[model samples]
Target: MGDVNRATTAAARAPKQDRSRATRQRLLEAAVACLAEHGWAGSTVAVVAERAGVSRGAAQHHFPTREDLFTAAVEHVAEERSTALRELFPQGAAGDRRAVVEEIVTLFTGPVFRAALALWVAASNEEQLRGRVTELEARVGRETHRTAVQLLDADESRPGVRETVQGLLDMARGLGLANLLSDDTARRARVVAQWAALIDAALGAPEDA
Candidate 1:
């Protein structure tokens, strides 16, 4: 009887746990969309909760403060972006550096990047958000750099290899910033091709080779 009762209780808790996770995910995704569309001044916990189809109280249950919610949302999306990049190139970016470069650039120009930019702007002005946003940006930057190194099969031990990779990311960010003003598709393709050639010249042999 005791064993059966324990098993029944465990089964009952499973669905509740699943629902809680789903609710949290909805709130995070909603927060990103709100930040992207509405900017920091417009995106409130109440607004995000409405977009998420959850109550404000529930949103707070997941993230007690507005800063907590937005920061966590951006971090969650960044992690998802990294996972997506890896999934898109499961075999690794051995050949076709152009494709890898283009995809990485795409990450910066996407909605998540826009949402993160909004947070960055807000962090610049908001004292309460500065530290968390700074820390989050640092972590995301490190992960992005590590991902680029892996995809490029780069050898950081080599002279200038690290800087070259960092330059690529910086250039991509600049391109993303430019893209925010207008459709830069034509110029972006040209730049991406140029960068791919430059990467090949700079990196020399792939780490595998």
Candidate 2:
């Protein structure tokens, strides 16, 4: 009888745990969408709660403040981008490398880029957002440096390697901004290709190779 009661309690708690996880995911995704569409300044708790389809009280229960929500959103976006890159760039058999590179640039030019830029712009006026953005950007830089170092066969501690990684990130950011403000897909793709080739060369991949 005791064992049966314990099993019943465990079964009851399992659904609660799943619901909690789902709620957290919903809030995180809603926060990202809010930040991307409205920028950080406009992404208040009330706004995010509405977007998440939760009560303001419930949202606050998960993320106590707007700053906390924004930070989580940035981290989520960074993780998602990193995961996508890892999946897309599987090892060996470098077939369709150019196309793969293009897809990477497209990801940068999509929602992730918009969300990050919005955070940056909002950070200029908000101290909390500024600090959060700095932390997130540093994490992203480390991730980029790791990938760059692996591809370029250079140590992360090397000066030129850091510069190369930063250059690629900056160029990718610019491509995203250009995509946001322009209607020229052909020109944008050409520019992105040229910039990517430059980074690939720096990574020892070379244009023809």
Candidate 3:
């Protein structure tokens, strides 16, 4: 009887745990969408909760403050993006440097990046957000650079290789900023192609070469 009761209690708790996780995920995703579409001034816990189909109280339960919600949202999406990027090249980026370049650029041109940019703009003016945003960006930047290096099969021991990868990311970010107002697809494709060629040259050709 005792063993059966323990098993039943565990089973009952599983659904609740799953629901909590799902709710949290929904709030995070909704927060990102709100930040992307509405900007920092317009996005609030209440608004995100509405978008998430949850209550404001629930959202606050997960994230105590507005900053906590938005920051966690961005970081969560950033991690998801990183995982997606890695999954895109399961075999590793051994030979297809152009494909890698295009994908990396795609990361910046997406809604997640837009949401992060909104946070950045808000952080510039909001004293309370500046420190958290700064720290979050630094961590994200480091992870992105590390991912880029891995995807590009870069050797940092080689002179200027590190800078080249960082430059690629910086250029991609600039392209993302340009994309904020307009499509910029045609020009971006041209730039991506050229950058791929430049990377090939700088990285001394792909492994398959």
Candidate 4:
């Protein structure tokens, strides 16, 4: 329902020049990698600056505090994923809705969601990060549900249909967290199958891809 490139990560930096925009992109990507691999404690501004191959002062110039850097990084990466999801879930019913369900499930269980999950865990206790994460999640959640509903061609006019659509995201994220520490492959597959059934039924599609 929304355009991903409309407010890109680079635009978030308000960069007036190509060089400045490049620097912001570098820092954002480095920050996403570090957050996914090392969690919040390891993703300091100095470390992110070093990883981005930029001076610490430059990082500071872009983001005055550690909180600023990570918060912006969170937003930058989310925008990036939203864009990619838009491409994957393009306009039309190319296949059965099960394919769309599986694709969205795969996205939540992948690296981008992993990084965002790490930030969410840390945000629970960290005041500054908590504020940003809370706001961002609300916006992202709304966009994700709207997009998924559109892809499924679901009848949101039906009762509880909108919430059921969002439930796919919640279910996938719960499964993603479970997979982090253990294989849980067989169980995850079952969960995906069941959720796909529920989603397909809601949208009046048969259980076939």
Candidate 5:
């Protein structure tokens, strides 16, 4: 019984597998909030540590480098936006086309897009963040394209679908920028409606237009 107890104790103390994960999360969330509030120039590892209520050394234990922290932060926010989009759309593979498109547009013109815009702006000024920003973009692009294909009932290999998806992404990005500048929900919806008409025409889907 003593030997068994020792073994259990050893296992319990075994480096706390992934114990740093929560710290990483807190740091990442802090990074995003800091970026949103201060923009890229004011976001520093020390500031993020203070924002997270952790010592700078503790934050460094989780994210050794500022680039790593920013990467994690951008990925976290992107994942959250992706999850929100998934929730807004249908559960099954098959979704209501009109609903999905409108919801997507609304999402793009809302909080998710605003956070992304901040990241984009920050990345534009910081060369170190450029690669991470590109990676985040590629991930979002692939996921968005996959969702669009599934919604449109088009083969991924189809030629026109790629262009359609690109156009939709461009439109969404533009709308997001508009939202940030204008802060007009009604205008954003109207912008989405315009894109909806164009997408409906391109997709040959009658429901949304």
Candidate 6:
């Protein structure tokens, strides 16, 4: 009996596995909140672990490294935001041009974008974070532009059409950043109105025009 017991391995606990995954998710959520609210320096693994109500040892077990944790957290945020965007702006969503533009601007001004901006600023000085941030930014930036173009119902083949769409994304991000330091609300309203009017003129008209 003693020999048999010594040979037995511990069974995999399904509930424990679930709790571990849930803990990891909480850590990621805490990291996002910290990044959005306190910037990169404040989003340490210890801080995230404490915020998630988990031990630092648990955090290290899941992430193994700071870069690993931040990378996974960023990816988690992107996935959540992408899902939200898809649900909010379905494929056939039809609305006023101004309203659509405002919605896109709102998307940029939200917490995910704020978290991304924090990553951007931190990655500038942190070489380890640069590669991951670049990969995510390219993917998210392209998808955002594509979605905005679709919502505008604009002909991308037309001259300068793509540029205009890209400009709108850039403008929204710019406004979001400016909003961090100052209440660029009035300025953003004016810019978005002008951009929406121009898009209406260009896209609402015939492609030949």
Best by lDDT: 3
lDDT of each: 0.93, 0.72, 0.94, 0.79, 0.71, 0.80
Which wins on lDDT, candidate 4 or candidate 5?
A: 4
Positional deviation of residue 112's Cα in model 2 after best superposition, in angstroms:
2.0
Which digits, one per residue and each the tens of the lDDT, describe model 1 over residues 68-121? 999999999999999999888887888767788999999999789889999999
Q: Which scores greater on lDDT, model 4 or model 6?
A: 6
Per-prediction TM-score:
0.97, 0.84, 0.96, 0.84, 0.80, 0.83
Model 2 residue 157 CA deviation in Å: 8.3
Report the C-alpha lDDT of model 2 over 47-140, residue by residue, as the tens digit.
Answer: 8888888889988888998888878877887788777676766652143434545665676787767787888888888776787788878988
Record all residue pairs in model 4 with backbone atoms less than 3 Å apart, i.e. clashing.
none
Identify the runs in model 5 with alpha carbons over 4 angstroms from their true place.
Answer: 1-19, 90-95, 110-112, 157-159, 205-209
- Give lDDT: candidate 6, residue 128: 91
Q: What's model 2's lDDT at 52?
A: 83
lDDT of 4 by residue, 98-137 (tens): 7777777776776677778888999998887888889988
lDDT of 6 at 60: 99
lDDT of 4: 0.79
Enumerate residue pairs that collide in model 5: none
Clashes of each: 0, 0, 0, 0, 0, 0
Per-residue lDDT, model 3, residue 199, is 90
Highest TM-score model number: 1
**What's the TM for model 1?**
0.97
Residues 121-161, model 3: lDDT tens digits:
99999999999999999999999999998889888888999
- If ranked by TM-score, best first, what sequence of candidates would result? 1, 3, 4, 2, 6, 5
Provide the global lDDT of candidate 6 against the true structure.
0.80
